[model samples]
Target: MDTTRSARIILVPGFWLGAWAWDEVAAILREQGRDVTALTLPGLEPEHPARGEVSLEDHVGAIEAAIGAGEGPVLLVAHSGAAIPATVALDRNIDRIPRTVWVDTAPVVDGSAMDASFEGDEMPLDALWEEELGQGSMRDLTDEQLAQFRRRAVPEPAGAVRDRPSLTDDRRLDVPATIVCTAYSADDYRSYAEQGASFLAGVLEHRALTMIDLPTGHWPMWSKPAELAAIIADEADAAAR
Candidate 1:
């Protein structure tokens, strides 16, 4: 835990988004003199022919490759659905990462497919996501920002979303995890974990599970990049200790 050691920060964006979604946050973190790389999951490009071919395993491999690129353990920052592959990478090799910061999402348990019942190779931006992420996070954005976001937003591949993640190692639970609560409060998330919500059961019970309160909608990176970057930097420093 050398505080002065240069550490790599891998930024993972959720569905319907590419590396561009993390532009603002990555820029702020870079200004802090930390190494940062935002990943674009395979098959997420606009009009990708392999959209239906991309599976959970493929996403896991992409994240794994990124983690392997660094010389030492990197701090992973996962937003929304990207948590799926990040968890897979951690579960497969926790030593590759010092810790993970989950943004507005909980770890997806093994053998569970996120939005499993969903069909189609690509799903359009619907009302629920519109309310939770798109429009709901507009309080801090200008008309131009919202318009650009909508224009750049792409359809998420169903294969990756519907495919189930596999975790063979329990050591992933030993890896440090911190949840940045935005769409909900720390108290609300605690209650859910206390009630043994399936997705959070293993993660919430981790010895290093930390919940940081950041009141806002699901897409805090878009609405509160400065605040989000500050929180993530603080968490990374703490993890290095």
Candidate 2:
């Protein structure tokens, strides 16, 4: 690994969010001279006409295209639901991705969808917030932050949330991974992996795995942007090495 070589960092936002969600963190990374690209996965754009038709594969292809356009290997940073397609995209483009940082999420196993119970053409942000407000994932967010989030949030396409990710290459297991623990402790996540948690079935299988303790809500990029950027930069440096 060449520690001096800088790799492009691709940031993938979670459900109901676009690349704009990463503005703060991306700005900090840029200040440190790191290349970063924040993505607005299919269907998450405001008033996208064909949003309802966007599938999981569409998100995967978007990630793949980003990696393909970059030079050398890239570092992927996936938040929440974005982890699903990002994991599949990383599997498909294994050679181009040297590492991935899963923020408050884990790389799901093959054939597993982000939410099997999700129904309808889209999941509105209002409905999601109503259900998730009391959840730990929403902790630490201020009233203003929550209000802004709701104002900017878009409806997530059902197919993107419901479709199962296809990971054919076992070599994806060889890629390095870092799990930034938020809304849960690192120990708790390790225990989940030990107990074979369905969503984290692929976590313990990674050849090189690192656990980071970033105690906050699920949206660390908003609540802890500077800390998140530091972690991402450290991992990006590690990936280069």
Candidate 3:
């Protein structure tokens, strides 16, 4: 396999996160002589003024633009809530993205959001979101991490989380994909199964879906960046073959 030609990988962060989340992971990949770019979705950073009105379309547009300017094929590495927008962007620009890697994230089928699967149930996401916002940086993290998280973590746009994506009828993508699972507890794995089984089942058809259990919380890129980057780089090299 020609590893040189497979260096392009784009990292997409989840809701309330910016590209800064991938700083350590990007550094690791770069140390290995790989090309990586971490993107900040609109409304997630202080520079983006449309935090209140940004929609799912805007999120996808930001990723699409990044892929458009890149050279050759890209392996999109999406984390947490980014899986939906990342996949939607690939579906829209199928020619640019050659592979997708979902990490500790919720997978969406067709154009559904992560919340769609819990339509009839009482999910804890709403409460978690409210609590996290109300408590601010005190919600989750040590004192050191809180200061940093506060600088980058911003309020998610209402429409982006609520709106359903527009998907193409084509079920198959031009490139293969893989799912890397990172959960802190057994309950987290069960949650992924319950909310994202439908989407995961579909991904199994056109690609080789692999799951790696990271004992860290949802953000392995921050907790174990070197390991995460190695897994991603290895999978990307294999996918190119």
Candidate 4:
């Protein structure tokens, strides 16, 4: 158990993303002297033959491996669909992680999949930012940024989406969570937790919920990298104390 108290951020991308998605945020965090590791989930490899065979447990094991690589208190940052596997990982190793940051997503008890239509085998980048993601989700992306996103976007494995999560330990809820509320305010997130919204019900009663209002679209690292990094750095600082 490498619990040295310093902070490390292991970023987990949401559907149809890879470690490259966190380049900007990772760079910023690096400047602040925080260790950052962005993960590309198993089966997310470009044309991986095992993609169809990947399961929620595989995803969880992948995240767990990333956390084990770090040397201190780790912060697992999960974006959108990645939250499910991250939550499951925490359930098994909550002591190693001090905080979990969810970007535009939270843990759910049922761990249902988002059936975003995959063109052929993978979800198209345009379909995600243009249709699936809310309008203006990519409004902050520059032409170059958009182009780079298209070039780097990898197909998310269908199995991971459809695979059911298995979390038997309730201790996962004891780990503090910080949700970077994009397109929604801290008040809005709290209200959802209060009302027991389907997406937020599982971790509504978490030991502590540190809500930060970013007010961007789903992909804040693309739209507001600096702000997003600052929020993550703040959380890391808090965790260190």
Candidate 5:
């Protein structure tokens, strides 16, 4: 038995998603005897009265709290827009998290907003789909998966996406990051980084950046759960070691 597999895994969902989005992947990780905590961020929960008031910092606080609550080593598995807050939280709690597994998303640099063009106090799932579809982010999802997502999706707080993140600590750049490319190839991601894509700026500056190509859609937790789980497990084990 490998004792290093003891690292706790924290899964953070992207916009319009909750902890439930990681169900399949979490179940598989659990079967492998890994501890997992899937987080439903501040405004992503249903029927929240202050949904519009939740800011990017609120999401960062939530992630920081989750990481602080864990013992030993911790690994973060962040998907899509969740990467914005996750990266800020990572900077605040760098020593606790040994590694981060970014799912089809990279860290958003300091002063960068997750969605600067987003209007209103909240953004609905349909609107997000319209934007993402143009990038082919929904390519591989099945109709059933799409329906299920639409049914469970919640409106993302505009502040969480529109507000910029602040990072005071530069040590976070030293932390290892594993980018699981789902909607695009690893080479494509590198090219974007090389081309100085603003969204990938932080990742480009990361000291230990590794990319894994797992071609699918943006929601690999539904489109390729097993493969995603395996990759996460591998990273968790590595982090534990």
Candidate 6:
């Protein structure tokens, strides 16, 4: 155990998921000799009493607390919907985070809400929610995977997803940031690649941001844990260099 080589990597799962979602990835990272912490946001666990009322601020606070608990700078990995909270947290506590990795995630630009990111014709959140409810427990995952996921999946806090993110113009941080987009289907891959390119174009224009593409689905940590862990470790190493 080389303590000096240990890097604190905090995993922030997407909506309707918990720390359990990152079990495999965390295990792999640990095996590779990196320190990893998988976070379960306030409303993510079935046992959490505030499951319905947990706000974006609450989730951000949780991430901040986790980062503060660590001894040094952390590499915050935000997946899907968690990207907003993670970005806001880094903005709020820029001193604590060393880097950020957005995994098949969404980034909310200035003055944009989650709702605003979607085009006028698509209803992603609503449609996805309805489909998930109809399918019961897991929508896209296989039976075995869904069983594993359901053991941890709880209803996400309504406010956490609804609230808008607030970021300051003090744009760049001391650490580097990377966005890894994973798309299973060709259409999804193309869509996210375009989104990632557009985002990297905007406010991120002047910042030192890295972007990578993976040939996996949105939940790569579950479907491709080894690959995901390797990519994350590579990013962490790059930041160190």
lDDT of 3 at 224: 71
**Clash statistics: count for each candidate:** 0, 0, 0, 0, 0, 0
Expressed as tens digits, the lDDT of each residue in 1-241 for candidate 5 is 4634568999999989999999999999998878899999998888889787998889988998898886878989899889899999898888798899999999778888966887898988887677777878888888888889889999999998789888889888888899999888889888898898888887678888899999999999999999999999988888887
Per-residue lDDT of model 4, residues 46-122, tens digit only: 77786666776888999999888857788788998898888888888878887778998886565455543332444
Tens digits of per-residue lDDT for model 2, 1-241: 3434767899999999999999999999998888899999888889799776899989989998888886877999999889899999988888788888999998888898878788789988898676788776888888998989999999999988889887889888878899999988989998998997878877777777788999999899999999999999888987776
Runs of candidate 5 exceeding 4 Å displacement: none
Worst lDDT run of 10 residues, candidate 3, spans 117-126
lDDT comparing candidate 6 with the true structure: 0.69
Query: Model 6, stretches more than 4 Å misplaced?
Result: 1-3, 116-141, 173-175, 184-206
TM-score of each: 0.90, 0.95, 0.79, 0.86, 0.95, 0.79
**lDDT of each candidate versus the true structure:** 0.79, 0.88, 0.68, 0.77, 0.88, 0.69
Displacement of residue 107 (Cα, Å) in model 5 is 1.5
lDDT of 6 by residue, 88-119 (tens): 88887776666778887644454434553333
Q: In model 2, which regions exceed 4 Å deviation? A: 1-4
On lDDT, the stronger of 5 and 6 is 5
Q: What is the lDDT of residue 32 in candidate 6?
A: 74
Q: Per-residue lDDT tens digits of candidate 3, residues 113-180?
A: 65543332122234465565564413334567655765557666665666677778354353666666
lDDT of 4 at 50: 63
For each candidate in turn, give its C-alpha RMSD to the true structure in angstroms: 2.5, 1.9, 5.2, 3.4, 1.5, 5.1
RMSD of 5: 1.5
lDDT string for model 1 (1-241, tens) is 3445745788889888899999999998888887788988888778678677778788888888888887766888899888888888888877778788999887767876777888887765653456655446455566787678778887777877788788888777777788998877889888887887766654564667888888877778977889999988876776566
In model 3, the clashing pairs are: none
